[model samples]
Target: MTKNTTINYREKIEHSHVYDVAKITPLEFQPNLSARINNRVLLKREDMQPVFSFKLRGAYNKMASLPTDTLKRGVIAASAGNHAQGVAMSAQKLGCRAVIVMPTTTPLIKINAVKARGAEVILFGDSYSDAYVKALELEKSEQLTFVHPYDDPDVIAGQGTIALEILNAHPEPIEAIFCCVGGGGLLAGIAAYVKAVRPEIKIIGVEAKDAEAMTESLKQGKRVMLDQVGLFADGAAVKQVGEHTFALSQQYVDEMIVVDNDAICAAIKDVFEDTRSILEPAGALATAGLKEYAKRNNLSGKTLVGIASGANMNFDRLRFIAERAEVGEKREAVLAVTIPEKPGAFKTFCRLLGDRNITEFNYRYSDPKEAHIFVGVAIADPNESANLVADLIAQGLPALDLTDNEVAKLHLRHLVGGHAPQAENEVVFRFEFPEKPGALMKFLDTMGHDWNISLFHYRNHGADFGRVLVGMQVPPNEQTEFAEFLQNLGYPHWDETHNPAYKLFLG
Candidate 1:
């Protein structure tokens, strides 16, 4: 349980066959980051390792130390991405077969990486634990050794070499070392060595709040199972910490900092700005923790090292990451507004929008009279959002602020539509259809425009159903007639003209 005790184990880890297998690198000081933080901020660029992660060290170490008989038996491991690649690559290099199990939702890039390394890649389940179960099953069936990603002593010790490299590369008296923790292997390894070598050097562990298994486990004094994990940071989305690693963490780690998804996004941006490298959310955790620590303690001029653990971000995920970045940095806000739908209403609304740059705009009409429109606007700052809302209300515009609504953020943002005109005697009807080919055209053909189309907004959802918000200008007071036409059209229709939720949302 003591620091020295963990160090003794780390010493053995350093001498292990795994450590001997991988090349050692220097921990470079980041002057730009240091100047900004008013401290010497060094980065332990484990991301620069083969397979682009620190996971390779541990996986290689574990594979190298396996008994000759065990090597013949092969190895099996489960991971969302990084560990799978590491183990696969290491096992292949060591002349052993590897079977890798990953969530079906894992990016294709990661799956291909494992396969490229000569590992048998199996896609199963929706989460790491589910994948773990399948891997365990394969292990028994094939009689292969389980090469754990972070739970094993050899893995932790292999990761511990990072600390040795950092200390040797930088001769300064270190104030703190911030590391990202998932199942605690990285933290366990680094903290053990650093705390033993320099007892005064603080070791802080960082975890995403949504997946802080180690933090929750330490609090409960037992490993706690998480019902769900936020996969935005797939690399560190562990449900539980390893027993041995957790014990080491409890003994050597000085503090545990949990950051939210927003902060992690902001940190990703920060690291990219500082190092011009795109770090996965898990990789950014350590930098995020340092930001939090600096702000909380008002500490300046202290030397610190933040581990940029990995950079295996999927290309497709960059869009979502960019969208979330503004909100993460408090640079954008999402708003809902109900504006009069008559002529000049939108133009007036635009004028009222003023100089606040619109990041996004979506609106649809549901009443033939064009009495109201639901709109979402993006603002420049969080503080400006309230003022904008207040200003809109002052203009007699009914608006509901949904800047923080989860549903609005995830489902509604991209579903917004462009404005269209309606006829005086046309009837307005809203319809939801499956987002498939010919769906919209079929709906339009069915309507047949005996009543001219007033307003129409149809968007394709990647799902089975597509929701369309529409409006038709029925001849000045043909409510009953429009109802009959909608009934004849045979699509589910809702009269949202007077609903309060409708009023607030689409007034």
Candidate 2:
């Protein structure tokens, strides 16, 4: 965090050899995004890199600067994502033997990509941390040089070249430069160069709200490890930021913004609309943060820049992203409305919509006296959802907004069923765990016949994690024991027993 460290990093970036293997990505102005937000928006196209990510800059620079004798001995690194590809390609370019340790759960496409670059791929363990431990052991046993993904000085300096490029591309007055934070390599590198050179320009970092290690670290005045991270933005999901990156970010980053998965999906769509290019969740992170920051501050007429970090998107995820983008963009509202079950009530409900397009509607006959419906309505303004809910209430129809409810958006809309009258003492809970073979079986085995499962729902979104909503029937006397069971289950969970959406449709 010292000024001396900042100067050292800036100097290293100024003379980095990243350009030996990494290309100079363009900083193109986004006209569509600019006009829509009423501010000039520029995108740093790192997604166009040879490895389809900015990771190559750091990985190559670190390897290219190594001593020839050391390179002959080979190198090793552990990563399950973009970093692995960066190292593989860099090693191929440098003609050095490279060994990459990746999780066993990594996709075959990624494994093949690394092997195609002539690097040796070793799949071990079930997560990055486990693979990292294996890599360390191999490094010592095989006497190979280890490449620390984001923690090393050389790597940080190489990543800093991005900031230098951004400044040279746009010399005009700028409002802020947004960078997405994972292990803090990208953001820390950008912040170091910007703060050292363009002190007047703001340097902001963006992170998923569920995986905000840097944000939490800066707030706590130290690096804090998270118990778990949401895997939707897996590219930027880090339990802890790197030591060097954390120190630099602590002193250089001006501000940090946290956004959710919905916002990320919307940002992906935003970029697609502007440039006809699709970005992965982490790649669109800074764009999402930029939109939120601009709206929150109400600033306009100034230039803003966002890093489109990568585009290694999974094809299977497009459907889920498309479904959530509308909600994220405030273009759609999901609601639960109750009305009299008498004849013509359904017609009255449609009449109340009054030309407002219904994106989706689901109803099930639950009670003789009342009816509950799940609905999705299109809206141009974000405030229109609250207004519509109020109007529905005024008309004597009770309405609850499920636009912000994770449970409702993820599962409830697909499950509109009559209440389970015979299911007694049922408690609904949502859970997330790393997706892998036998994961669900492990969950079931952990339950161990302690409670009967009344209802269950799960759908894959092509993410590293799996989400499940379960209703369990636990006797009142065993509530304390059930609490202990959940505590020891080792999965992130939320109690949704009293959730309004659950009560209306399936309680």
Candidate 3:
């Protein structure tokens, strides 16, 4: 409950019982990333754990430390990710009953994995917080020991063993160690050990920008609860950092870095190139942070290490990750160019590109005077995108960069046909709906047939939510009524009515 000086994290970590169920994962050298970043890089391969996550270390240690009577009664946990498997596998290894409460919205693959490990699975609520509440109720009612995902002292100590392993395996100098923070358990544990044993080694925590609970918490000198967290890296999407973990992080963490989803995808690719292992978004967070940190500081020839936390990637999400990897690495530039609709226009554009590889080209003749084309070009340097745009403008082709535009990348790139000139008063909106049955029907039923549907685009990227881009014909007089409709919908929505991509393509 409090950061007591009496709690010896080093002693607890040194004597952790994790080896009974968790493996001592390899600290492997990354040749590709090392060569590319000009730094000696090593990856702590926690992804190679028995349950394919470092979570087993903490889970097993916590369970093994429990009293005999408590273990006999059983253990309960709430998680929709690696923690659930960690607890389940630990329970199986200990020959104790385990019950895991998971969100109903959790993927079937994960649910089945826990069940396969011989743990009773209870699908409850819509999110991890909701499931956690249910788990507490069940824990009290059934007299089950609650195995917290990260907040417990035993759990933090268990995770700290990773720091011991890294320091023992590589006795050489380590400039910094990067690890991802969700509820701050992983970073908290690692930082606590590193700071105590090797204070000179920097312990940096990485988080997704949209789900930066630890970053904000450390900034305000307290734990801050977020209203919502982006689920791209669902493993590290906790809205609030755990109390014990936050306390440890406050004392030991050196720096906090936030990265976007694109960088995470690129980090996945980086790991795959060196190790041929695919890491989930959260698993790749530390690598992404390491790359950013190295580039930002312009540090070369330093020994850097990152923890590859887990590899429980959903097969369906690969398509989306692969597509964003190029942009994240600054290897692809997306642009919208306006060229005269005449013969040899394409040739002239190609000439201007000057041997640069074209990744994608989407075009449809809309106007006799001009043509708007969506283009993706390969670039070796990040600065090349600006230079290429300048070249286009100098050659009389007006070019707009859409590489950073969410609307352009998610919707406009696919809807690059001729505009609907006849759809009067058309307004575009992007909506996120829960990826469940009848979600679309619910949206349509609430819409109430007041406006005409002019355009619609929906794509499933194997995420928890379904993203849809919609265009509707609403009269100016009813703008207030349309606004009220969106508010009542209860779904996250963004207005793209004036987005340049829509204006140039579908508007």
Off by over 4 Å in 2: 1-7
Least accurate 10 contiguous residues by lDDT in model 3: 1-10
User: Tens digit of lDDT per residue, candidate 1, span 1-507?
Assistant: 433353476566558655444667557677775776688787888888788888998898888888899898899998867888888889878888888898775666777888998999888865577889999999998899998988888889888888888888876788899999988889999998887787899999999987899888888887888755555566887878888888888788888899877778777887777778898888889988987887678889998889999998766557666766676666776777766667888888889888767777766655665443434455655778788888889998866676555444554454444323323443334465533456667666766645655445554322223556565665656666666666666554544444333334322
Better of 1 and 2 by TM-score: 2
Q: What stretches of model 1 exceed 4 Å from their correct place?
A: 1-7, 16-21, 25-40, 338-354, 366-401, 417-507
Question: Model 3, range 79-144, lDDT digits (tens) per residue?
Answer: 998999999999999999999999888889999999999999999977898999999999999999
TM-score of 3: 0.96
Against the hidden true structure, what lDDT does model 3 obtain? 0.92
Q: Where is model 3 more than 4 Å wrong at Cα? A: 1-6, 476-484
Best by lDDT: 3
RMSD of each: 9.2, 1.4, 1.7
Give per-residue lDDT, candidate 1, residue 62: 83
